[model samples]
Target: MANAASGMAVHDECKLKFLELKTKRTHRFIVFKIEEKQKQVIVEKVGDPTRSYEDFTASLPADECRYAVYDFDFVTEENCQKSRIFFIAWSPDTSRVRSKMIYASSKDRFKRELDGIQVDLQATDPTEMGLDVIKSRAS
Candidate 1:
């Protein structure tokens, strides 16, 4: 589907992979990027189910804007195991203004395609979406 505001169509694989992650736990996270040439949002990477959160963070480019979804599992204060699906908007400070604008404009529509996200995070640096922040949000 395409968003009128951003004029970006989300690649079919993006939603398909997200379904596998959300329902089958086939992946720990999925990273997406906007293909300026194609005017489409495409899946850039998929973290294996056993991958750590650090691996997910590392998959992102240092000077780019991307969208990602992470399946976070944690033990709660009540001693229960829980999971939260996070929609992350990653726009590092070093990215170009045009790239940032494209991602910012397309984020909501892209997120809406992934129906099960439980948390929304906007991160400009590692500190913003660090494990500590995720842990806090999970609880």
Candidate 2:
């Protein structure tokens, strides 16, 4: 394994492609609030409080940063790739969402993989990811 500061164990060709891929694609870009002291991030819906969720960023208490945030909307399962995220709908077709996270990874395979992360959405089933549903009928 490469040292934490040195770099990633990746090839040059892949590096070039990674750059292009990331530049070409953007992530879901959901709104979020960061709690450094608590190491927590809460993902909120756009102008919709009834639909929202929160998740823990770290196991131990540590100082976190917004740079640690990520997209989670392109999920195939509950809490997609992790890092507090979301995805863009690829097409009008309901099934194949854009899944921006994949593009982010392709851009830099080992740039800074923030593993062991989670994202909370307003609904139990994130309408996009299909997690659970929250009864936010509106006040």
Candidate 3:
């Protein structure tokens, strides 16, 4: 596929890496960055995120980090109870400072937005940022 705005073909080799989300089930997160001027996409892994919201909040810088609980979920499957929470943290004007933490469930929650862009603020989220999904099962 091509980026219509730049008339540039989005290459397959651009995919970089994957991150295994430390959720109840087998979940993974992928990252990608597209530089239209550079004609390149960089991919990478996110690793296991902090399972506790408190630890995550405590680690962030008070003045520089912005946080939000995008949404929450109560999962009941096969006698297993798990809570999936969607959230985000970003630094407004800083480099390498944006994150959209989400979960995978087969249900709808609600609609949300950040920085003028619609985000997946639901359990069974349907959203993507840039070319991150180009090399994943979601793609």
Candidate 4:
């Protein structure tokens, strides 16, 4: 489906892969990129379930805008194991202004397609969405 604001269509594979991650924990994280020429969002990479959060973060480009989803597993104060799905909007400070604007405008629509996201994070730098931040939010 195409988002009205940016006229960016999401590829079918995007949702399919997300469903695998959400329901079966098939992936640790999924990175998505906007293909301006195609005017669509496409799956850039899929991290293995054994991958660390640091590996997921490393998948994002140093100076680009992208979107990602991560399945975070953590233990509660009561020692209960739980998981939270996070939708991340990544717009680095060094990215092009046009790219940032496009991502910002289309973020909500794109995120809505993923049915089970529990936490929403917007990060311009790595520090903003650090492990501590995710852990705190998951708690």
Candidate 5:
């Protein structure tokens, strides 16, 4: 019984560490177009919101920046101006096997993919491995 409990604790610790690494590796990007007439910048995040849906929008605290620069183009036809801002964040993609393999390799770990199944490089046969087993092995 104690062995089982200790094993569960170890599993939980590994799960938490895995999630921490995943979040650390996750990337976020925002791209939007702004017109000269536009007074405010609108932003939205996709996924489970920490706050209520209604309160999420209101959660964006307004701030004023003293120094700002923008490179904009003029629309001759409409006699207006606009700019497109691209905010890019690059991080690892954990969904795909290749990406996972790359990340693992970078960390001095190795992974292997066989017949559409992902497994540790040490795993000789992944035929019997399920999603849960593969995930546990990823740690």
Candidate 6:
């Protein structure tokens, strides 16, 4: 199939690389970035649940990192959970407001699998989600 946005046909070679991104089933948590239009899933990562909620990247002088979680099971079309995403760039005195979020939807979680489906707040991103799944596969 062709990518609707880029109009680039996903070749057999491209799919082989995508297959490498597959996450094996495990007791761990998994995250998937699914392109609804393309029906292609980019399995992100799997990680320890206890270690997923916090930041572990080397603190950079320019780029900052933070996370957010969205649960579709407990979310409704009208009312929703309020959440925040912070990306404090630079130092303590010169940080930039990178990204922010006050709400999350179940629709966002529908495409990904995580431990205890409904409570994935600790599994911040797809990479963490993938880690959890990979861990499950190992055991």
RMSD for each of the candidates = 0.7, 16.6, 12.5, 0.6, 22.6, 13.3
Candidate 4 clashing pairs, residues 3+ apart or interchain: none
Question: Candidate 3, after superposition: displacement of residue 128 in Å?
Answer: 17
- TM agreement with the true structure for every prediction: 0.98, 0.19, 0.30, 0.98, 0.17, 0.24
Residue pairs in candidate 5 whose N, alpha carbon or C atoms collide under 3 angstroms = none
List model 4 lDDT by residue over 11-76, tens digit each: 999999999999999999999999999999999999989999999999999999999999999999
lDDT of each: 0.94, 0.28, 0.29, 0.95, 0.23, 0.28
The per-residue C-alpha lDDT of model 4 at residue 45 equals 98
lDDT per residue for candidate 5 within 11-118, as digits (tens), equals 132223223223442212111111113322222232131333223222222221111111112243466553221111112222345433332232211001001112
Q: Report the lDDT tens digits of candidate 2 across residue range 1-139.
A: 3323322233333234323323432322322322223323233322221222343222111221112222333333465442333222211122222322322232222333322224322211124333232112110
Per-residue lDDT of model 3, residues 7-115, tens digit only:
3343343221211232232222322333436543333223233343333334334333222332122334465554433444333233333222111110112112112
| TM-score quality measure for candidate 5 | 0.17
lDDT of 2: 0.28
Clashes of each: 0, 17, 1, 0, 0, 18
Local accuracy of candidate 6 as per-residue lDDT tens digits, 98-133: 221211222232323222222323223344434344
lDDT of 1 by residue, 31-115 (tens): 9999999999999999998999999999999999999999999998899999999999999999999999999999989888889
Worst 10 residues of 6 by lDDT: 83-92
Clashes of 5: 0
